[model samples]
Target: MADFVDREAIRHCLARLARGEDRRDAGLIRAAWWPDATFDYGVYSGDFAAYLDWVVPGAEAISNTQHVLGQSYIELAGDSAKAETHVISYHRVDMGAGDRDTCIGGRYLDTMARRDGEWRIADRVMLYDWYQDWGAAIDWAEGVMGYPFTAGHFPGRARGDFSATFFAAGQ
Candidate 1:
């Protein structure tokens, strides 16, 4: 029972982290890490706060982003845990002529600890499995109905988007 609960808590933490990145919510992203946590992502390796500062703006620059989570394997020992989670992320970049889509397959190996009864990541290393990029064939914004799918109608991940309003309203 304890293992199950720990697994769930750790999974929730990971989910929150992913949602933060997808939604561009800095606070939510910050919540996933301890104050002195560390991170390594091949391209960058430093404190968690620095990682957040570096990643958030870059993510915001993209037109849209989505992170698809797969499986997580966790090992728990009392108030500490280690996990490896699989992920596939998609980013759309507008380049005037057309949009470029990048797909990345990776895994996050994390060391987590429970502090004050809350689980947060203490250290994380992101391993890249594969990556690919190509021009998008069809633009969703220019669908057959001629309506821009991302234009305010649907809630977005970024600040001031509908999701922020919806979440703020508590519905």
Candidate 2:
């Protein structure tokens, strides 16, 4: 039962971190990590604060992002745990020409610590498995298969995104 609880808490932390990136929510992202937590993503290696400074702006610059988490393999030991989570992330960006869709498949190797009864990441390392660059993003204006998206509510990369309201309303 304790293992199950710890695993669920760690998984939830991962989910929150992913959503934080997708929504460009710095505070949410910060909550997932310890102040001294470290990260290495090949391109950058730093503590949590530096990681936030680098990541938040990058997320803001991108038109959109969606992180799809597949599965997490966790090993628990007392108050600490190790987790490797599979992920596929999509990004829409302007490549100095037009909006392009890109995706990368990766895994997040994490060292998690349960402190003050809350589980948070103590360190993280991201490993890339594959990458694909799709030249152009589909025109959402044309909609999917020519059927328009429901008019008023569109997804956005900010705290005021539709999901926020949905969650705020206790749904």
Candidate 3:
């Protein structure tokens, strides 16, 4: 039972981190890490606060992002745990030329610890598996296959998005 609880908490933390990135919510991202946690993703390496500062703005610059998390392999030892989580991240950005869609497959190697009855990541190293640029983004205003999707049917923004409002009300 204790193992199950630990695993559940760790997985929730991972998901929360992903959602925070997609939403560009600093508070949500901060919740997933310990006060002194560290992070390294090749481009940046530093304490968690520094990482948060760098990541949130970077996310905001992008038009949109979606992180799809796959299977996670976790090894538990007392209050410390190690987890490798597979992820496929999709991003829509204007890379100098124009807006484009890109996908990156990677894994997050996380060192997690339970402190004060809360599970959070103590350190993380991101490993890249592959990357692909799918060229320019399509015109969503044209609608898909003659089916129009306007109004509330749109991608979530970094802030003031439908999902953010929905989740906020629930809390």
Clashing pairs in model 1? Answer: none
lDDT of every model, 2 decimals: 0.83, 0.88, 0.88
Backbone clashes in candidate 1 total 0
Clashing pairs in 3: none
* Per-model RMSD to reference: 2.9, 1.9, 1.9
lDDT per residue for candidate 2 within 78-153, as digits (tens), equals 8999999999999998887778899999999999999999999999999999999988877766656768767545
lDDT of 1 by residue, 1-171 (tens): 888888999999999998888766789898999989999999989998798887676643476778888999999988899999999998887666567888899999999999999999999999999999866735544643665655644534422457666678985
The model with the greater TM-score, 1 or 3, is 3
What TM-score would every model get versus the actual structure? 0.84, 0.92, 0.91
- lDDT for 62 in candidate 2 is 73
What overall lDDT, based on C-alpha atoms, would model 1 receive against the true structure? 0.83
Worst 10 residues of 3 by lDDT: 151-160
* Local error of candidate 1 at residue 13 (angstroms): 0.6
